[model samples]
Target: MSQNIFIIVCIIFVGLLIIAEYRAAKRLDSGFLKWVAKPAASLAFVLVALTGGALDTTYGCWILIGLVFCLLGDVFLIPTGARTFLAGMGAFAIGHLAYVGAFLSTGPEISGLFLIGSAGMAGFAILALRWLWPNLAEFKWPVTVYSAIIAIMVATSFLAAPGQSSAPNWVVIAGALGFAISDIAVSRDKFITHQFFNKSWGLPLYFGAQLLLASSV
Candidate 1:
């Protein structure tokens, strides 16, 4: 697609995402909005990536794969149940690993930025896991593993920033950080407290992050 057309499509889908988030914030029960609008919003990122020529390069291809897995994660999360939640988590974990692969495709340098980012992420992971430990119950180990994967994903993005040419460094950095921060909201909603406040901010951050990453393609 032409650049103008791509921008217009992105704007339209962003509107769709806003409507979906509004629906989610207003309702607690699962219904048509959850099953239909939510996934449609999630699918927007994949469309964005494809139209942006995500399949044209190795980094873009891996990012497209990650976006697809994240879409599945969004779908799996629509329903409320332990099995479904676990399924969603697993999908997201895989998505993070795909992101790691995408960064690796850039042949990232182990610069000071990488070391600092890794250390910062490690610290955040320790704090977050400790906070969630009390309520994790049977999900403790799984959550831990997922956290580790996501931390690595973010760190890898930092590592790739100085060398990757597939996308602007700011796009990758902002997308990764936004995604990681949004997950804190998810964790709080799921394990700490149930509130619309979490979804209100988390959903937007998530979709924005995905859109940014997709546009990078």
Candidate 2:
């Protein structure tokens, strides 16, 4: 019961932090809030996972690690620079790998749904790369590699969705899809157009996805 309470509190806290982060980045243009709230929001998910007993199982442990890396990515993205952006991307790439590891650890069955999902994810990756290729500039290769990693992560999530994983199938699929879609917003904001519109949708989707994954623990 206490654990459930803690999870609820953390969820509320994370939601508020995400709202504050959006305001800081878009409306107030406040660096202090952006720096504080973004990482705080990420950390709240980590706490949620811990409170949910994430360290008790192999799948949960990998998810915990992924969340930590995503937290680092959030921190790296708080500052504005090419190097920092690259660093942030690298961290997120690592986080995606950790998620892939978590999903693979589930020993998912190789079913028709899994094959279809994998193919769809692969096609999405191809289309996304084509869309972003022109504006990627010097970061083209890194972004391509990162895109591939996330695609694989999503594909593996599909594999883990057949009641073989610690998380419910719907939760696993929704979290992965949300996370992947949110990245499109991020990519558009960074490489195509620098606008608040991107964050309006992306931040919520990203945080929600993280929260869902945390809850799975």
Candidate 3:
């Protein structure tokens, strides 16, 4: 029941955020102390991930530190939404870097890794460039930003790639892909056209990614 409530609260929180950002259409700066729940939630989430023994091994405590900043970025950057969003992106980027370190990689099956991840990346790129280009043409500056995110996501499956005998290769791949899917869903929420998708697909996809990420430990 607690887990269920947590999920519900998360859904409501994100939904409200989307609504608030859209309605305000202005970036709001939350002073440091004004928003504590985000960091608190992130810390609790990491604690749960650790205690749950995600990915069959221990993770660096530093990742929690990064996530704390991510929550801060998310909460504060919602108004103008650009810089703060980018800050959150930076936080996640660093967090992924930590995951790369925590991952005692056995070198991914380059054959499968390159083939799948590259293909998805290429597809998303082409689709975005060809079909969605004009829709986002005004925000050309952010093209690089989205591109970097794609690059990181393609490495998503790589994080779980068979680490130190305890980490199975398949599990790593699943976890990475799950994370990618969540980010993809997040992109859908931000760029795509539809609130129903945000509620139905984005939230669930993010949870799926988080679940898979936890499985990594």
Candidate with better TM-score, 2 vs 3: 2
Q: Residue 217 error for model 1, in Å?
A: 1.6
Ranking by TM-score: 2, 1, 3
lDDT of each: 0.82, 0.82, 0.49
TM-scores for the candidates: 0.89, 0.89, 0.61
Residue 214 of model 1, lDDT score: 80
Question: Candidate 2, clashing residue pairs?
Answer: none
Instruction: Output the worst ten-in-a-row residue range by lDDT, candidate 2.
Output: 159-168
Clashes of each: 0, 0, 13
- lDDT tens per residue, model 2, 1-217: 3445644665565566556656755567566656666777788788878887789888889999999999999899877699999999999999999999888887777777778888999999999999999999998999999989999998888766423434437787788899999999989989999776787788878988988887776
Residue 208 C-alpha lDDT in model 3: 43
Model 2 bad stretches (over 4 Å): 1-28, 161-168
Candidate 1's displacement at residue 198, Å, is 0.4
Give candidate 1's total backbone clashes.
0
lDDT of 3: 0.49
